[model samples]
Every structure is written in structure tokens, then in C-alpha cells.
Target: MFSPALLQMILVAALLSLLSAGKLTASDYYVATTGNDQNPGTLNQPFRTVARGISSARQPGDNVIVRKGIYPQARTLNLANPGTADNYISLKAFEEEEVIIDGSNLQKDATLIAVLSHHIRIQGLTVRNSQNIGISIWGPGTRVHAVEVSGNRVHHCQNSGIYAGFNRLHDPVRDLLIEDNVISECSLMNEGGRYNQWSFGAGAGLSRKVTIRNNTVSHCYGEGIGLYLSNKGTIEGNTVHDNFSVNIYLDNTTNTRVSRNLVYSTEDQRFYRFNHPASGIQIANENYQGFNNPSSHNVITNNILIGNYIAISSGSYQRGGGLKHTLIANNTAWGSIGPLLHIDADTSHYKSRISNNIFKQTGNVPLTDIQGSTARIEFSNNLWHGGVPQQSARSTSDLEADPQLINGGSFNPEAYRLSESSPAHNAGIKLPEVEQDFNGKPRSKNFDIGAW
Candidate 1:
């Protein structure tokens, strides 16, 4: 038998052999504004342009650290190299410095940074001023999975600030994470042009397990954060506001979860004459030629929808699309001119549940919740301000008393906490799927009526 030290030496020799053969070897390349491409991409002699770093030879676990400066040469930080799952190709700003990749003058392409490969991590940078998309991720040839686009500021784009789309059903951009980023002032060209696909803060297309969380997406011309033909992901803990269209939109999605998001002010100030919809949250069959597919098996929970044109809605086209096994629970909505919850579909056979939500409208608009026939309506324990149980209402367990909300008339919408003496303090039926309250706190022994 070989000795333990001898065995370890043999393994180390094998690893060194692989490194010498360039299979397990990874490099650290640097880029700076004062660098020269002719120099070796080291700390002292870095590459001048992002394209030069992209053109360099890189293996898995390689890093391209960009220094702090304005990269005037608008170029595509293309990911042509694939990384391993354990060790990804990292493209990050130097020590959390401000690395601005400005694409204002670039006319060659619509996207600034393009992710064509797999297992890439792009973080801690500012991507802005593109004609179309600020950062575009497309799995063109093979499957591009496990990409993390985090801690960056993506804004001021024409169509979408960040668009991750994969048309190939087999090879898709799956297992993606877009978190903790500020995406604002996007979709400048497509203001209220929903049919034109003009503007969106962030969008995911034809992907699975793509989480969009802990981000601030606001002031866009289209949806603040949209999932088009995408399914099975969590859109949670996001502050989404002030979009021309829906603040958070899910089109043709299945088994999706949207929880603990602060969605407010989906007001179309740009094209008010065009009469944009501007719903706070929409789960529907629209966009991307996917209007007819079944948008079912979804959950919208623990969201705070405030001061929007419409709080929540689900729309179906003429092609007979609808929702099934959907749940809208524990949300807080106020100051909406339209219906608090409007669900319309072509088919009468729908199964949806609305429970433990708060509906308080300051305006005189009628407080109505739509339900189609054959819908398993569970509208119970909802706290409505100045609301009376009507004959047309379905839930007999609902309460028509004041919720006793706090500081709702103030400038800060986050002050909609339930008062200690409020009727909404502990009046909800807690679902097993909903473990945390809207404030991410542990639910009390008796759950609250609406989102905290």
C-alpha cells in the first residue's frame, strides 16, 4: 500500500500537471483607463479596454477586475468563455470602486454588456445609457446557467435596463440571480408603448429558477420588473415603484412566488393622454406572443401595493387564457382609483384564493373584487376600511371594520404598520407557505390580517 504522504504527493502532482496543461489554470486580468492593451494584464500593466480583456485567453475561475473610472469606449463585455460551476468567471469593480461603463455613444449594438457564456458573475459596476438594453444576457449556442448579476446600478436604457432572454427552450439562462441592484430611469424610448416593447427596468424571458430580489426598480416607462414566459422563481423583497405600466408583472408564468415586495405608484405620468393601465402588480397572459398560455399555479403574497392606478389584476386576451390554482394573500393596498383586485379571463373555470389582505381606499371609487364563475374564492379575513359586506361578495368570513392603520396619510408609504389596537392585529389565517410577515419578521401566534 502507498503511504498517505505519497498518495497526497501524487494527487498534487496530477493537479500541477493539469495546471501546466492549462485546464485547471485560471488567471487574474486587470483593466484600467490609463492601461495599454500591449501590456500584460497585471496590476502594473493592465488592459486599456474591456474588449481587450474579453479577447484575452481566460479559463474558469478567472477574474477581470476593472479599476475605477469612466470607460469612454462603449464596448461589449462579452462572455465568450465558460466557467465551472464551483469557480465562475468574475467581472467586478476594483474594491467596490465606481466603474461606470457608459454606452451613450455606442451605436453598434443595442446592449452594453452581453453574457453569451455560462457561470459568470458581474457585480459592483454601473451600466447605463444604452440605446436598448444596458446589460443583455442571451444563451445563444449552449445553456447559460448559474449567472449572478448583483450589486450593480443599471439605469437609463432605452428598452430594458437588463434583459436576460433565451429563446431556445432546451438551452436557456436558468438558475440566474439578480439581487441588491438599483435599476431606475430605464425604458426611455418606449414610454407607454406596451405593444412596442419600449422600456422596462428589468426583464427575464424564457428562463427558470431566475430569482429577482432585494433590488430597487423604479421610474421606468414599462414594467418595473417583468418575467415574460418565465416560471418557477421568487420575486421577493424588492422596492418597485413609479413605472408607467405594472410595477411587477408576470406574463405566462407558472408556480411563481411574489412575496414581501413594496410595490407602489405605477403611475403613467409620461403618456397620461394614451391612458396606460399602470397596475401595481399584474399576473396575466400578455407580451412575447405568450398571451394564450395558462398563467396558473402562482402565488402573490405579503406585498404592499399603495397608490397605484390599479392595485392587482389578471388579464386574459381573446385567445382564452386564464389563471388556475392562484393565491393572492396578505397584501395591503390603498388609494387606488380602480378595483382593488380585478381578475378577468375568458374561461369561467378558474381556481383562485384571496385571503387575509387589506383593502383601504381613500378615494370614493368603489371597492370591488372580481371573481369569475367556478372560481374557488376564499375571500376571508380581509380588513376593508369603511366597507360593508354586500350580497354579491363571496367571503362570509371577511371583516368590514377599520383596519386602524398607522401614518397612511404621510409621505412615507412604508408607515402602513398595523396598530396595536387595530382589528387587523391578529385576524389572519396563516398558510404554511407564508412563513414570514411582510416586514420579514416571524409571524405571531395569531397572524396579522394584512402585510405589515
Candidate 2:
């Protein structure tokens, strides 16, 4: 036998040779449209259907590029193949906004489904009008990167525009980047398949490292984005609006950052409906199912929480366990009929860090912890307007004063400010700086009054 160093050199040489000689060529693949399946699936002599392309993709690095045009087929493209990290199976749009995957005529109880594939990217296509979810990523560890799902307009589907979760077999679906996609007008009732509205607009289970950003998720039957049992993902810089549920729901999740998102119309401030369907963001324990632990150490900061009943809610639906060490900071909320922040529920002692928020309300108490536990929801320096007290509780040091805003009460609907004679103009408690005002200036003091 050869020496170990010689074996290593031989392996490296073989890898380099494969990288150089086994490179993929675009001209070697075929095209599939509607008509004759007997044709040689080349670009010039293309086959008639997508079914033939699947039969032809027998190798690991083989590609079958779906050309741009209206594909009227209503069948689910179940790719029974796997691609490697180097050679991936690509089913991309021939041209941006020019290719369409029409699922309009799917039979009753017939949903278009893609299943059991690996290392595949569905790029730049309009997948819409189905009985269930328009696009379902069923494979475990599938990477859906840089696909423009705009003007595709998935509607009237019983489920979601694009739903990603675990399969019935409990396979893992992780490391998915759902970006620049538009998923709207999908039904989110109690009855659905595989993925449900109860978890996420699309939910994930026991998965980590998912980034869902820069998408417009509106007018759905469920929440804009619901995360259950998801850990360490960035749900940032997205516009989630007009869903029946919370703009973002975090249940039994942890180490997730929700920032720089615009969530609006989450509340109806009408008198009769006051606190009935009150709109606000919620981070609850979710009844403490035996499967997962309670949510902890979540950083909810630097977002605009406006036109809702309660801006932020912490430690809800706690049975016996406690929600510990959640950071609710750097958020601005206005026009709340109920308390701007409420952390009162049936649970044992809980620990939460409530600090540095901007609350503008109609005399709605800014901070409230009705649990009456000895370890109250901690608070430091938060800005409040409209004569609302900082905390309605009897223990905490509630600062009831003007927060000397730049535009005064005229600019703030709740009329929050530090009067020329008041000391709270810049006299805020010392804290770390996270956000600045509209004028790009840091909080003149160490703490900013409201969510910028």
C-alpha cells in the first residue's frame, strides 16, 4: 500500500481533475413545452412536457431548465432526483416575469405538489391559483435562493402562497432563504395539509438558520409571519400587513431577532371593538405543549408597532412555566385602546427586560404586569405621551413625565414631551443606544424615548 501522504495527494489530484473536467455545460440539456414527448429534448428539438424532463435528469449534475412561457400543466413536478453541492438541478424561469407555472385547472381534492428533492432552486417563476398552497418546499434542507415571486399572484388557495414546514414523515426542512416573494390571498382556516396557519404564515419545526426577508405578505387569512419552534433566524425588513392574526407570532421560539419591520392595521381603535379584536404583537408561551420549551431570550426591538390595541405583549398563556429574559426594547407604538404593554397572565414568577420603548396612547397605561408576582416585569427608561403613567402597578419606579420629544405633542398623537420646565427632556435613564430619531441623530441622552 502507498503511504498516507501519497494517498492524500492522490485524492486532492482526483478532486481537482473532477472540478476542471466535470464542469457543467448549458447546451447539453433539453427543453420541455407542451406536445410531443418523443422529441429529443434539446433546445432546438425540445420535448413537449415537463414529465419528460424528469425522466432525462438521471445524473447528479444534470440540469433541466424550464423555458419562459405559460405552462398550462396542473400536475405537481415531483422531482425524484438529487443534486450535489457542485451540480444542482435548476428549474428556473427562462426570463424574469416572462415564465409562469399555471395551476389553475387542478382537479378537486387535487393539489400540485413538489416532493422529495434535494439541492434544487426554483427561480423566477409565477406559481399560482391552486387548491392548496401554491408552492410547497417539502424536502429537508432545501435551499430556495434569489427567486422573484412577484406578479405571480397566488390566490384562493386553501392554504398559503408559499408554505414551508415539516412533511408528514417528520423530515427536516432547514436553511431556506424565502426572499423577494409575494404570497397573498391564501386561505388559512383550521383545515389544511402538512403546513398550517397555526404555526407560521409558513411554519418550521426544530429548524435553524432561516432568513425570510424583503417580501410582501398581505391579505392572507392567517398571520403575516408565524414562527413556532424556529430558532436563530432573521425576520427583518419586511412589510407584513392586513392579516387576521398577529403580524408576527413567536411561540416556543428563541434567539430570534425581529427588527426594522413595518406592521400596520394590526388593531381597530373603534370604541365598540375596543379590545375586542385588539391588534398588537404577541409573544406567548402557547400553552406549553410537551414537545417544546417556552420562548426565551428573544430580542424584539427596532420596529414600528402602530395602530394596534396593545403594542407589545409578553408572558401570555403561561400555565406553570415562566417566560424568562425576553428583551422588549426600541419599539414605538401609538393609538392603543388597551395598555400599550401588558404582561399579566396565570403563571409563576417570570423575568422580562422591558426598557426603552416609545408609547403614544389615549391615557392607556404604558406598562402593566397584572400577574402580581414578586418578580415584576422590569422597566428602566421608556418614553410615554398623552398623560399615560409609565406603570399602573404599585411596585416599579414608574417615571410619569414629559419625554421632551423633538416635535412636541403636535407631532406626537399622544402629546408626549419634556416640557421646557420639565426635567425629562433629555433626562432619560442610562441604557445602550440601539436606534436614532427621524433626523438621524442619536438619542441626545443614552436612551431614546420611542421606537424610531
Q: Candidate 1 residues 320-391, lDDT tens each?
A: 366578888899888775777676635643666788899887877767655555344456778777454334
Which residue pairs collide, candidate 2? Answer: 33-48, 200-226, 358-450, 386-414, 403-417, 404-417, 404-418
Output the number of the TM-score-best candidate: 1
Each prediction's RMSD over C-alphas, in Å, is 4.6, 6.7
lDDT at position 276, candidate 1:
42
Q: Ten-residue segment with the worst summed lDDT in candidate 2? A: 269-278
Clashing pairs in 1: 187-199
TM-scores of the candidates are: 0.90, 0.73
lDDT of 2 by residue, 1-452 (tens): 98999999999999999998986453335555553578777777776666577667766666665676667656776666666667666555555435666667776534554635666555566766666667666545544322222233344556666666553213346666667776666654433222344423444454565566767666666656766666776676666665554667777777877766666563332211223332457776665344564677677776666555566765555442454767777666665646666665545435666666666565544444345452545766666566545333322433555545445323232333334554344434554535444223466554544554
